[model samples]
Structure formats: C-alpha cells, structure tokens
Target: MDSGETKISLKDAENEEKEQFKLLHKYEAEVPKTFEEAISETGFGRFNYTLLVVILFPCATQMVETVGMTYIVPVAECDLHLTIEDKGLLNGVTFAGMISSGLFWGYLCDALGRKKIIVYGYLVTGFFSVMAAMSTSKGMLMGAKFMSGLIMHLSKSKAVLIPIIIFFLFVEFHAWNVFMLICASMTIISGILYMFLPESPKYLMSMGRNRAALVVMRKVYSKNTGKPQEDFPVKKLVNEAKQNFTSSRVEMATALKSGWEEMKTILHRPHINNMILASFNAFSIVMSLNTLKFWLPGIFQSISDYQNNHNGTSSSMCVMLGEMSKPKNITSSQECSVVKFHAWNVFMLICASMTIISGILYMFLPESPKYLMSMGRNRAALVVMRKVYSKNTGNPQEDFPVKKLVNEAKQNFTSSRVEMATALKSGWEEMKTILHRPHINNMILASFNAFSVVMRQVFSSLLVILTFISATCMFCIYFARSSLAVTILSAAGTAVGSVPENLLLTITLELFPTTLRTIALSIHLTAQRFGTTLGNAIFPYLVQMGCLPPFLFIGIFASATGLLSMLYANTENKPLI
Candidate 1:
C-alpha cells in the first residue's frame, strides 16, 4: 500500500454505511498518529511542557473573567441597583451569544485552522473582561460580559479556556474567597501569551500539510530538548496515506457537507434514541448544577443572617461596597469580611472541588477514535491510539494494522514462530474493518460524535430553568437561618451533579473520529460554549428572582429537572480507546 499505489474499494455494501453485524466488537489495538509519533520518534526528548504551558495559558484569562463576575455579587447588587431578576437576566443574556457561535468556531477550526482562532478568542475575551469590569451601567456591563465570552470563545476550551471557565461556572458563586483582581490580571496575561502558540501538529498533518506539521513538531520537541527524530513511522504513514486516498484538496464546502452528512446519519440511526437520552440527562445536570453556580451568592447572602449575627447593624452589600471603593487590601485581610457571603462561598467551594475530581476521571476514559477514523482522518486516529496504547505498553506500535508491522513481526520470529502470528494479525485487521463498517450508509462513529454535541444543546435550554430554581431554593434556606442545611444540601446535590457533567468529556469521546481528533475537540468545545452562553448569561437573573421572597418555584424546577435527567442514557460504562 505505497502512497503511490494504494487501492480503495467503495462497493455499495461498504460505502453505504450499513451494519451487517449484531454488535460493534473490538479488542485491544494501537497505532501512531501525527502528535504521538512526532513526540515518540523524538525518542530522547523530554516532554514539551513548554507547549503545554502555552496550551494552558488561556485558563488564566477564563478564571479572571469568571472570578470577576461571581465574586463581585455583593458589589454588583448595589452599584447597579440590580433586582434579583435583573441579576438572572445579566448572567443568562451575557452568555446568549455562545449558543449561536459555538458551531461556527468549531467548524472554522476544522476548516481554516486552530491556533489563529484560539488566539483571537483569548484576546477578545480579555478585552471584554476589562470592559465588563469597568462598566458603570448594568446594561453596559451585561453587554461587555456577553461580548467578552463571544470574543473569548475564539479559542474555546481545547486548551486553556476549559479549566478556567469550568472553575467559574462551578465555583464562583459558592467559594470561600478568591482574589478577583489577581484572577482578572492573569486573564489579561494569558490573552497576550496565546498570540504566540503554534497550531496543533496533528491538525496540520491531517490536512495533508505535512511540512507544517513537521515544522510545529520540530519546534515543540526542540523546545523540550535538542534531538533528531528516529525510528519514525514514515513507512506506516506513507502506506496509510495510500490506503485512505480521498482528495487532499477537497474544498472546505465539500468537507463541511461531508461533516453534516455524517452528523445527520447518526441522529437518524436506530441508536439515535441514545443521543436523545444523553442530551436530556446532560441538560438536567447542567441545569441543576448551574442552580448552584449562578445563584450561590444569593443563596449564601440569605443564609449568612449577617444582620442577625451583628444585630442587623450593617448590610453585607454596603460593607462590600466600602471595601471595593477603597481598593485597600482586598485579598487577605479584614477588608474581605464585609463581602463574606459565607453560605455562597461554601457552596462554591464544594462544587469547585467536585469539578476537579471529575476532570481527573477523564484519565480512565479514552477519547473515542472511532469517530475520527470514520471521518477519513486515519493519521490523527493512529496518533490517538498510540497515546491509549502507551499507557498500556512500553512498545505500542507492534500491533499496528499496517502490513509492514505484520511482516516485520513475522521476520523477527524466523518463521519458526507458529503460523498463528499471521492468523492473529489477519484476524485483528478483519475485526478493525468490521468495527469500521458503514451504518445506514454513513460513518456511525462520526454521526455519534456530531449528535453528542447537538444533544447537549437541546437539553441545555430545558435545564437552564432547572438550574435557576435549585439555587433559588438554596437562597430560601439561607433566609430561613438554616445556613448549615443549605450548605449541606447544595454540596450533596453538586457532588451528584458533577458526575453527569463528566459526560461532556465522555460524549466527546463517543463521536469524535480518530483522524480529526483535534478538530472534533474544537467543535465539541464550541458546543460547550453554546451551553455556557445561554445558561451562564440568563442564569444570574433566574436565580436572583428566585432569591426574592417566595422562591419555592425555583426548587420545584430543580427537582423536576433532576428526575428528567434520570431518563438519559448511562454513558458511564462506555468503552473508550
């Protein structure tokens, strides 16, 4: 299967995407895609931690924006004369832009590139933060905040934005204390830094721009340590390129069409019900969790009974305002006491910790490579497989599906090796093809990947109300002078909700194709932006209103949504690799 002489068969049975088997069966397998091979081929090298730093820099900005918004609740309540409903509207409306733009950014990342958009997203988000922070009017502030997310979504979460945004969404409304100024400052720094990182190497290679991929890889490795790459999988790739010979120069329009076709095919399949279930379940969790995220401040405010504690002498809002006006030692001192909304801070801390634990869970779950390979991006698939395998073996490329691997393994055995070696290799290759079999005439994995995001979006709208109500109830508990009750209940609910959010990552693994892992990642992130925009923006207003007298309606919403969440598919047991 030399690149020059590779053959392809697209018989109606194969290209039609029909499932001839009763189940999708897979055994352990491995290969090397661009990034892993680039790293591995440079065998003597240390990991490129520098690039990781670059990749993670945007998080600083995200955290800043989040902290700035969530921590400033008391201050915001006073300065803008914000009603509870106004607060909810501010949170929800600000995020409104995200829903419309997420898919576009993801598609752009796939078509045009990654680094440029990411840089653009970071800088834009930073500029908006500054605008939002300095605003004098609620409308202006909301506009600025919404614009910030819209701008920041330029990079999405494929890199730095992921952790930062997640932190704020899950933590800001509930934490004990955080330095908003420092967080804001960090975001500005990251926006400036993102302008410098190179594109993901795997992205370039899949586009048939090997020279660009090679350049980025060399720089990444060189930054780690000076070394020449060796034991490369050059022959393997050359053969793969031959086998997967779709036109390298396919127009962006056509590629987009193919991507859409792949997306629709999944939604229409028999298992499509799973996609619906996944969406609703995810939505339910998001709605309920955001209940805590968007309104924890109000909930904490009610429960603090600070007035009763100090004989109702001074409002915490006024106290916070005094601290903000003076710019006097806000980080570690008596100054923060005025703004200490104890109940809110405690809930935020609980949720934040839960979010951290969930991220760690992703290690046990491999990103789904089936989606990528199904999308005709085999090179990227191999790269992902290598990562999955390396975790399992010191030598991961031995069982690669290429013929060269089989022949080499045979020769090394001196043919004295039982013919079982060839039989084993042949059986493995056959299974690989079967798992890849077309379904309803479309790439099943790719369909699953696309639907995963769409499902998320669908349920997000429904759950937005759910989150609003839950937080509102917690606020009522706070008002009842039952701070402990509110704290314990909110914490328990958040811990449970956190596991469902992990579905975000899990769903990404379900549908993303191996060849376009980075690209698909970018798209899924955009889908996340969709959730953040609509939910986070409107979130503040919803909870704030519920915080007002008689917020029982909010509690009903959360309870109802939680029950609904139980209806979605349990992707917890999904197999990844």
Candidate 2:
C-alpha cells in the first residue's frame, strides 16, 4: 500500500511539472515585441556596410549634377556664349526648379513610394542631363538642367572638393559635352540599379500590405544571412491597415490631401517658432556655401587667367575679380582658351564611374525596417532586425531573441483629394503662422543671421578693411606675398566658414520635436536652396557694380546679423520636444 502511494505521488508531481512547462511556453509565445526590441537583436554587420556603400550613389550623383555646371561654365563660355549673368542663371536655375517642385515631389514620394520615385526620377534626370549635355544654346541647357533639378531631389557634401580637383585635372580637355555625358551616365546607372532594390516595407504596410512587407524582410534575411527563405524566423505579420482603409492602393488625391493636412499641422503653434528660425538659418548657411562654392571654379579660372597674363604679379581676390569685371573684346578668330591641367579627364572619369559603381552595388540593399515599424508592419520589421542580427553575429535567424512584434503605427489619416485653391490657402496660412507673434522674432533673427553669413562670403575681402574683425588670418590673404600663403589663408577661411553652419543645424535640430523635425529640415533646406539661388543670381551683378559695393553690402549685413545672433535663445543642453 505504501509503495502504491509513493508511485501515485511521483505521478502527480510529474503532471504538475508538465503543466508548468506548457504555461511557460504559452507566456513566451504571447510576449509582444516592440520595434526597438526587435531591431536590437539585429547586430550591425555585413548588411550595414553594404547599405553604406549603396546610399553613396545618390550623393555622388547630386554633386555631379548640381556643381557639374559650374565646371562647364568656365570652359564652355566661348561655346555657349555665356555672360556673367548667364552663368548666374545657369547655376541658380536648378535650385529654382527644386524649390518649385519640392512640395510636389514630397507628395508624390508618399503616393507612389520612395523606391519608385527614386528610380524613375533618376532615369528622367539622366535623360534631362543628357539633353543638357547636348544643348547648343544657353536656353536649352538651362531648361534641361532645370528639368533635371525638378526630377532629381536626392542630392550635397564636402566631397564636392573631389570633383573640383577632378574638373581641374580634366579642364584641359575642354570637352564640356563629354563632362555632361559622364554626369548623365552616372545618373542613369544609379536609376537602373535602383530598380533591383526592394521597396520600403513601411510603404507597403501603410498601404495595408503587411504580408508583402514581410516577404521583403524575409528576402533581406535570406540574402544577409546566406540562408534559405524557409529559414527566416517570423512567418506571420500583424495587419497595420485601418479598419475603414483596407485597400492596398494609394491615390495622388489621397497623398495630396494628407500632405496638405500635415503641412497645416506643421505650421501651427509650438512648431511655427522653430520652423521659422530653422528655415532662416538654413537659407543663410546654404546660400553662403553654394554662392561661394558654385563660383569657386570660375574664381580659380579667373586667377589662372590673371596669373598667366601677368606672371609675376601678386594680387588679392578683389584684384582678380576686378579684372574679371572688366569688359573684354572677343573675336571669332580668338581660340577658346581652356585650362591646361594634367590628368583631369582621368579624375573626372573616376568620379563619374564611382557613381555608377555605387548604383550597381545598391542592388543588394533592403528596405528600411524603421519605416516598416512606422507603417505598423511590426512583424516585417522584426524579420529585418533578425536578418541584421544573424548577419552581424553569424548566428541562425531562429536564435533571434524577439519572436513577436507590437504594433507601432503612427500614421493615421482620412482624406481623399486636394484642390488647387486649398493648396494656395494652406500655403498662405503657413506663411501667416511663420510670420505671427513669438515666432516672428525668431524668424527675423534667423533671417538676419542667414543674410549676414552670405554677406560675409561676399565681403570676405572686407577682412582687409574691418580691423575689429577677429580673423587676422583672413586679413593676411590680401597682404600675402606668395601664392602658397594666399592658398593657406583661403583654405583656413573655408574650414572656419563651415563651422557656423554645423552649429546652426544642430540648434535647429535640438529646438524641434521629432514629429516636426523633418518638416523643419525641409523648411531649412528650401530656404538654403533659395539663398543659393538668390546669391548666385545677384553675385554677378554685384561683381559688375564694383568690388567695393559687394564688400560694403555684405559687411554691414554680416555685422548686423552677428549682433542679432546674440538674442537667440541658447539651445545648449535643451531637450527636444
């Protein structure tokens, strides 16, 4: 009887142990996963390195397109019959196109999908770029370049100096068309390669295609991990679509309506002040940077011209520019003088090929998992994270810690179409918001600061006259006896000038909330582009008016803006909303 009792007790204990095991498994299965938790599992490795390489194509292409004209202007002056004003127009036109189409592109990116827009946009830009290369007349080139800018928005960087060096080496070729062709080819290659890239999983989820998003993630996992599709850990995805919005289709009308509503929200209280300030700062910095940058090749060319004619003469930037302002007699018999630099073609070719190579490699990239989470495709995001983890750690996908994802859909809106009248009205309201109350002072300060910075570039020569200005090295540029000294001073100025922009951008980022950060940045970029356009457009006229006017004009503005910066609220250590 005692032996029977012992057996029965042992059996009961075994049963309880099994039940506890089942309960533990159930809890583990039901545990929800957050995007951050899911993504943390993916360690950075081979996938991230590949992504870094691929994204560089867009950046390279943008540099080639926007500044490519600057290189051409100096060499093509004879062929294109370009004047100072015409050069200004050529440089500024692209930005004008960008500004005009900025909102439209933003809406289209939402409606169509980022991948679609990027691929097709690049192809169209390449076509226009080729057209620009083939243009015999200024008007045709201008139109082509403008169209390129209108279509191409994925474009900036310090790497601009690399192209400058390349152009310098290649300037002797005097093959402006060839240069343009190179730029076009780079853009086209990028567009073609973009075709092989996966669409944004977030966009798919936004359109109520969570399963499609998951499929993309799984493919990414397989590629990153060198594993079969069947090995991907996550098999199920949560539905991210709103109950009433079950369709997987997105219309232009829907996008526009949503965009306009979002724009309105961005322009309202709490955001207005930050936006205005940020925009103004962006305009100033970009304008200053581009105005000087676009004209740099021309400036160097003029210096070369001056030095060639008067070999022993040492002069200031004003002297070179002053000589450039003087009218010249040109005859049909006069040969088009090209800069005779060595190995320029090779460098330019290298720069061009780099873009193509980056594009081709871009084929290996996957959709952004962060975007997936935003679209409420948590499961898809988790899969991507797992792939990243396995690739980074050389582990199996099943070993990924997170098993299920928590829905984190942030975008929810109801709208069908947008009307032209509504767009205009909303734009006006946005402007009003920017100009209203506490924000107005911020705008004024930012605008003044921007204006000041650009003016500083224009009157950089004014360092000679303003004894109070602390930049003694800049003052030395005017007095420098040798080319080497002048070069050093100029390099120093370039390095120092870059600092203010970084500070202002950081401040802008710190002052705004994450929700409005992108819009604020957009505002900043738009303003910066506008500044570039305005500065380039006016720079030629300023040069023509006389060296002193440009200097004085910029000097006073810079001085005033420097003071205005004093009133700006300190952004240091301030938490973003």
How high is each candidate's TM-score? Answer: 0.53, 0.67
Per-model root-mean-square deviation over C-alphas: 17.6, 17.4
Error of 1 at 367 (Å): 39
- Residue-level lDDT tens digits of model 1 in 422-455: 6897997786567545563377767887876676
Native-to-model Cα distance after best TM-score fit, residue 252 in candidate 1, in Å: 4.5
Which candidate comes out best when scored by lDDT? 2
RMSD of candidate 2 to the true fold?
A: 17.4
What value does the lDDT take at residue 453 in candidate 2?
68
Candidate 1, residue 54: lDDT: 48
The collision pairs in model 2 are 42-389, 43-389, 169-344, 170-344, 284-450
